[model samples]
Target chain A: METQIDKLEQNKKSKEKKTQPEKEELKGTFAAVLIVGGIILVGWLGVFGLFLERA
Target chain B: MHLHRYEKIWLMLGAGGLALFIVLLCVNAFAMGMAPPSNMEMIDPEKVMETPPFDKPGLKQVGDKEYDAYMTAFAFGFSPTKMEVPAGSTINFHVTSPDVVHGFQIPETNINFMVLPGHISSATHTFDKPGEYLILCNEYCGAGHQVMATTIIVK
Candidate 1:
């Protein structure tokens, strides 16, 4: 009875490990997209500001 | 917490404005690299043309004689390959282009100017001390632009 219980517990832990890598990758991608998008938006604004001041 | 409709719109706009600022800073920095240093006080090309006074203000006198260095901006290379100047001495540089327009820059010393065809460009630099400096062509003339660079040696 004890042996069967130990086997069931080990199987559950292994299943949890599989999802960890996928979760980490998704988090990394989200952070990168946010930073790049922020940079592009700022560049456009500066050019516009220069033109406005000149006008 | 639940937010009202007006608050949500303001929050989105704030985030977007912050992002726009960062992008502009990067683009401006990139553009600055293409040309010479914009600050006039640092690298003033106009100071190069006139003759030195008896008071010897900004000019450096080496061995009681002025060295005339010829830097040609031609199809492929700069003629002398290396320039040497004494420490605490003001050296005059005569830059000319036998071909198209090219940019001359010494990034370490913040020396940048343009050499146009059918005209002579001149600049003077006072070496406060001694070290090696680099000179580069900032403009994208054509092929071989990448290798269009030389060095200035100060003793």
Candidate 2:
């Protein structure tokens, strides 16, 4: 039972170590996603605003 | 399928954005009445002129300041030739084509529709300012397409 608990704690620590690098890498990906989404939102709103102005 | 944590988060955000767009479209179309113009009213293209209302393409007062304008979009030009409405009056324009597909558009107003042969297209606009509102054919019909335009005099 003691060996099993020790194995579980080591597994959790390794998981945290692996995720630390992944989290840092995904920060740039998240920024890029937000930039792309912002462009699309701006374009859509531009057209919608033109429609309303013509209305 | 197994997905990474960031992948799941981005996927959810993308889906949420799409859902928000759909909800905005619904609200704008149903609540704000910004939907595109469409009417399923069909007629015989050949007999359009001989038809009841199309025979006399003009306006009929429907309410205090609302008028039903029956207009025809012909090959080279629009019928009736002249249309005059008072400022602040609302005109519900019911238009159609007999020869070919034409376009119905009023500048500075949200009254643009396709005048398809045998199909009736309608759009409404209120002329609050007294001026000449030009209606032009935005679709290419033939050589005379450029001249296929008229004016609505609001006085």
lDDT of 1 by residue, B55-111 (tens): 122223445436555566655666567677666666566566656778887664535
* Candidate 2 per-residue lDDT over residues B3-78, each given as its tens digit: 6677788889899999999998899889988755667889999999999799999999999989999999997999
Residue A49 in candidate 2, Cα distance off native in Å: 2.8
Checking candidate 1 for backbone clashes, the offending pairs are: A39-B23, A41-B20, A42-B20, A42-B21, A42-B24, A43-B23, A43-B24, B60-B90
Q: Once superposed on the true structure, which residue ranges of model 1 sit more than 4 Å away at CA?
A: A1-55, B1-66
Expressed as tens digits, the lDDT of each residue in A1-55 for candidate 2 is 5798899999999987886644455777877988898899899999889877865
- Residue A21's lDDT within candidate 2 is 47
Q: What's the C-alpha lDDT at position A13 in model 2? A: 94
Clashing pairs in 2: none
